[model samples]
Target: MERFIETLMYRSRWLLAPIYLGLSLAVLALGIMFFRELFHLIVEIPTIAEANMVLMVLSLIDLAMVGGLLVMVMMSGYENFVSQLDIAEDEEKLNWLGKMDSSSLKAKIAASIVAISSIHLLKVFMGVKNYDDMQLMWYVLIHMTFVASAFAMGYLDKITKH
Candidate 1:
C-alpha cells in the first residue's frame, strides 16, 4: 500500500499538465486581441491625433509584452513542472528552452512584470488628463511596488546562490 500511494502521489504531478496546456488558449486569445488593436490603429491612422496615435501604439506594445509574458510562463512552467519536451535536434529552438529552472523563470517573470508595468505607467501618464490625481498616484505606487518586489527577489536569489 505504501508503494502504491507513492506512485499515486508522483503521478499527481500530471494533473498540472492540463493547466499548462490551457495557457496556450490564453496566448491565442491575446493574439486575437493584438491583431484587433492593430487593425483599429491602422484604420484610424488617417485622422488619429498625434497624442492618441502614440497612446494607441503604446497600447499595442503593452499587449505584445503581455503576450510574451504568457508564452514564457506557459512554456517554462510546463518544462519545469512536467515532462521534458521532445524536440528534434535540427529544428530551430529557443536558446533558453530546457535551460531555465524555476528560480530563473521566477526572476524572468518578475522582471517582465516590471517592464509591463513601466509601459503601462507611461501610457497612463501620456493621457494624464483622463485620470484623476489620486488614480495617477495609485498607479505610480502600484508600479513602484512591482519594481521593489522584483528587486528584492533578485537580491534574494543572488544571496541564496552564494
Candidate 2:
C-alpha cells in the first residue's frame, strides 16, 4: 500500500500538463490580436497623429513582451514542477530551455513586468493631457512599486547564493 501511494503521488505531476497547454492556446490568441493591431496601424497611418501611432506601436511591443513572459513561465514552470522535457537529438533546441530554474524564472518574470510597466507609463506620459494629476501620480507610484519589488528579489537571491 505504501509503494502504491508513492507511485500515485509521483505520477500526479502530470496534472500540470493541461495548464501548460492552456498557455499555448493563449499565445495563439495574442498572436491574433497582434496582427489585428498591425493591420489597424497600417490602415490608419495617414489619419492618425504621429504620437498616436507611436503609442500604438508601443502597445504591440507590450503584447510581444507579455507573450514572451507567458512562454517562459509555461515552459520553465513545467520543467521545474512536472517533468523533464523529452526532445529529439536532431531537432533544434533552445539554449535556455532546460537551464532556467524556479528562482531564475521568478527573476525573469519580475524584469518583464517592470519593462511592461515602463512602456505603459511612457504611453500615459505621452498623452498626459487626457489624465489628471492624480492619475499621473498613481501611474508613477505603481511603476515604482514594481521596480522596488524586483530589486528586493534580486538582492535577496544574491545574498542567498553567497
- Per-residue lDDT tens digits of candidate 2, residues 1-162? 999999999999899999998999999999999999999999999899999999999999999999999999998989998988888999988788899999899999999999999999999999999999999999999999999999999999999999
Deviation in angstroms for 142 in model 1? 0.2
Residues 68-119, candidate 1, lDDT per residue (tens digit)? 8888888888888887888899998898989999999999999999999998
* Per-model lDDT: 0.91, 0.95
Backbone clashes for every candidate come to 0, 0
**Clashes in model 2: which pairs?**
none
CA shift of 73, model 1, Å: 0.9
lDDT winner: 2
RMSD (Cα, Å) for all candidates, in order, is 0.9, 1.2
Please identify model 1 stretches exceeding 4 Å from their true place: none
- Residue 105 deviation, candidate 2, in Å? 0.2
